[model samples]
Structures are given as C-alpha cells and as structure tokens.
Target: MEERPGRFLGVDPGAVRVGLALSDDDARVALPFDTVKREKNDKAAARQVRSVLEAAEVPCAALAGVVVGLPLRLDGSEGEAARRVRRFAEALELTLGVPLHFVDERLSTVAVERTLRTLNVPRAEQRRVVDQAAAALLLQAFLDARGQETWPEADSDEAVAEGPSPGDEPAPAGPRGRERRAGARPRRKRR
Candidate 1:
C-alpha cells in the first residue's frame, strides 16, 4: 500500500467501552475502527489501548497523533466524566509516546445516534457502533479545524483593547485556544 503522511487515532472513552477511530493516511477523514473494553483505572485502560493500537501494526512513526473526546457539560464546565477521560487520555499519550489532543465532545454521541437513526440503522447495531461513530465525529472535527488557514493567533488584552484598528474585520476562529475562539476561550456572559 502507498503510505501517506500519517494517521491519527480518535478515542471516545465511555463508562464501559472505549471507541476508536482512525484517520486516513492523509489524516483528513476519520473511519470508525473498533471498540475496546474499558478498565476501571485510567492507567490500565491506557495500557489496554496501547496493545490494541500495536495490534494494528501502525508504527509509532506512522501516527500523527491521538485525538480524544472530552465530554464537557452543556454549560462548558468539565464534570467527572470529562475529568476521567482526561486522565485516561493523559496516560494513553504517555504510554504511546505520541501527541494527544482533546476535543470538546458535548452531545457527540447524541449527534451520531441521530445520524444513525436517520440512516435507519437498527437500534441493536447502533449500540454496537455508536461509540466508534462518536470517535469518528470527534476526529473529523479536529481535522476540520486544523485544516483552516485563516485562523489568527491569540490576541492579548492590548490586542482586544485595540479592537481591530477601527475597521479591521473580526478574524475567523482558530484552533479554539484563544479567548476569542469558538471553544477554548471561556466567556463569562452568555451570548
């Protein structure tokens, strides 16, 4: 097979099972891969995930990174589930010795279920594959955001105070880190 740049693994950690998805060799599209039984502890789960990835035989060098779903609350606050996922992701990154990224996964599963229902997938089959689909959604979102070119760097207080020099257009959102981006920057008041 012709090798491309690299592949990225997407993970969705649930209470009982962990879903997995993999990006195409070009790292553009996400395909649902498999699901693994979760361990009670974060480190153990990480190890289990490592083994699963190794079984795929995609060398470490071939992995561009790992994208994990972070199930943040509707109000944008992290709950226990989010915290647990973070812990698991951290351990997995350390074990795999690869880059790890977390994407806001609020309602990701719900969206996947909706899509599956629209596709007329059986409820039983949906249960078997929803997690993997959610993983693909998370990875796809990350890939989409990373592909944007018009994103600007984070603006400091002075930058925001400058307020675009009277006529400058508001910059398109970046990779969601700055105070003005779509997800990372926390806003005090609801818009």
Candidate 2:
C-alpha cells in the first residue's frame, strides 16, 4: 500500500466507548473508521485504536498528529466530562508520543445524532454508531477550518457578539406555517 503524508487519527472519547476517525494521507478529509466498546476494561478501547494505527501502516515518522474532541458545556465551562477527556488525552499522549490537537466538542454529539437520524439510522442501533459518527464530524470540522484559505480568524469577542450575520437570513416559512431553519428543530425561547 502506498503511504501518505500527515496521517492523522481523530478520536471521540466517551466514558464507555471511543470513536475513531482517520484522515486521508494528506490529512484533508476525515472518515469514520470504527467504534470500540469498553470491554473487560477501558484498555480495550485504547488497544483497538492502537491496532487501527498499526494496521493502517501509518509510519511513525509520517504520523502527523492526533485530534481529540474536548467536551465542554454549552456555556464553555469545563466539567466532569471534560476532566475525563483530559485524562484520556494524557494517557494517549504518553503512549503515542505524537502531538494531540483539541477541537471543541460542546454539541458535536447532538449534531451527530441529528445527522444520523436524517440518514435514517434506526433508533435501536444509534447507540452503536454515535461515537464513530461524532469522531468523523469533529475531524471534518477541523479539516474545514484548515481548508479555508484567506479566511480571517474571528476574534472571540466578536464570534458570539450577535445573533446572526447579514447573510444568515431566516429561513422561509414552511408549508405548515412553521418557520424553522432547514434540518434544525424548532427553537423555543425560555420564559
């Protein structure tokens, strides 16, 4: 098999399972690889990921880096879940000796669930597939961020300063007289 440059492995770590995604040789696109359940112990998940890296023949010299999703609250506060993610990262770093990149994953799972549902994944089977889907989504976001040439980085102060930009016009009313963004659930205002 031909080897590629910058072979990146993206991970979505969970309490019980870890989802894996792999980028193309050039590290441009990320595709879902596998979801490993926590077997006899959580060590199984780590082993499974290690196996994928080994079987892919991704040379250590060319293994560019790893991307890990960092769990955070909607308000950007770190919590217990975030702590677990940190610990997992620490362990992986020790084992892989490769650099680890963190991507904000505040709502990645929710986004992945909606995506899977739209793809007609059965409810009974979603749990089995959610983590891997999340990994793919996270990696895709990371790739898109890097692919945008000449895009200015928005300052944190301005990123959330307003509701929507000029181009973000509200979606047209639907046939049932409901106004909802395409593929998004209707929003409810808090009292």
Candidate 3:
C-alpha cells in the first residue's frame, strides 16, 4: 500500500503576494513559512509556490494536501478574488498533484491584522507577515476541525477549487459526498 503523505500545505493568495504555511509532521499544527511574490501570471505563481513546498521538511511528494484560502464575500458569495484564487489554486493543484481543499476565509486577514496590532507589531512588520499569519490561522483551523471530525459549517467550501459555475453541473463532492478535499479521512460510514 502507498503511504499517505504526512504534511499539509496552506496557501494564502493575494494580488501581490502568496503566503505559504506548513503543517507539523502529524498535520496537526501549522506555521508560517514564506511569502512569495505573486507573479503577473498564475502558472508562474504556481511554480513559485511549488518551490516553497519543495523546500519544506516534507517535499511535494510527501504532501497530504493543500488548504487554500477562499476569499468569499461577507455575504457568502464568491467574488473576483475568490475566482482568482480558484485559478491559481487549480494551477497549483496541477503543479503539485496533491489533494486540494478550500476554506472560507472571509475576514481572516482582518482577524490577523487585529492580532498583530494588539501585539504592537509595527505597520511594516505587519505588512510583511500578515499573509503568512493568516495562512497559518486558516490551516490551523482546518487541522483542528479535521481532528474533531466536525468541520465548521462556515469555514468549509460547498465546492472546492473545481467548483461549479453558472449553468454548470454541480461540482463533485469529496468521498461519499461528504464535504472536504480529496485524501481527507473519510467520514465514518452510517449504520
């Protein structure tokens, strides 16, 4: 049998930046890793993210999955930013050939900014670290929920990066129609 990978990668994508995070060997905790410049093209950006994943303690070949921040609007509708992320995430999923999932990330950066300010982090420092911090926050949330086997309703995506568009068939759900990305622990079977 093939060994399931041991680490999860987190991604926080922005117009000008892409934050990367890596989980502990057990995929139980996440820590900020690096911030890559978002190139004008998404394939280039995926290449940069691939570089970061390869640099982690666990290489891309050992990746369990990727959890990407899906920037949904406050109203729970996806906007331009969400679409943009889906594009980069799709390209990245192809580049890495790993399982892909999306976590609703409305206000995640705002929350991180508030914490940084409370900690008295200077504006310049906050700008440098906020995205990575947000990635860690999102990844941690996912890991915690996965541990409990009850993912938060608001944090999960109805469809992952390969979501359905208007006039399209509903996107496929994770194993057995339960919500999550591929490679996640399957929900316990019903009696």
Identify the leading candidate in terms of TM-score.
Answer: 3
Angstrom error of the Cα, residue 167, model 3: value is 58
TM-score per candidate, in order?
Answer: 0.74, 0.68, 0.74
Q: Where does candidate 1 clash, by residue pair?
A: none
Model 3 reaches what TM-score against the true structure?
0.74
**What digit string (tens of lDDT, one per residue) describes model 1 on residues 121-185?**
99999999999999999999998887764345457443235345768766555546433643455
Provide the global lDDT of candidate 1 against the true structure. Answer: 0.86
Tens-digit lDDT string for candidate 3 (1-191): 34366788899998999888889988989999888889979899898888776665457878889999999998999989899999999999999888888998889999999999999999999999999999999999989878876444544775244455558654457765756654566578799
* Runs of candidate 2 exceeding 4 Å displacement: 1-5, 39-45, 59-61, 149-191
The TM-score of candidate 1 is 0.74
The C-alpha lDDT values of all candidates are 0.86, 0.78, 0.86
Candidate 3's error at 75, in angstroms? 1.2
For each candidate, C-alpha RMSD in Å?
12.7, 11.0, 16.9
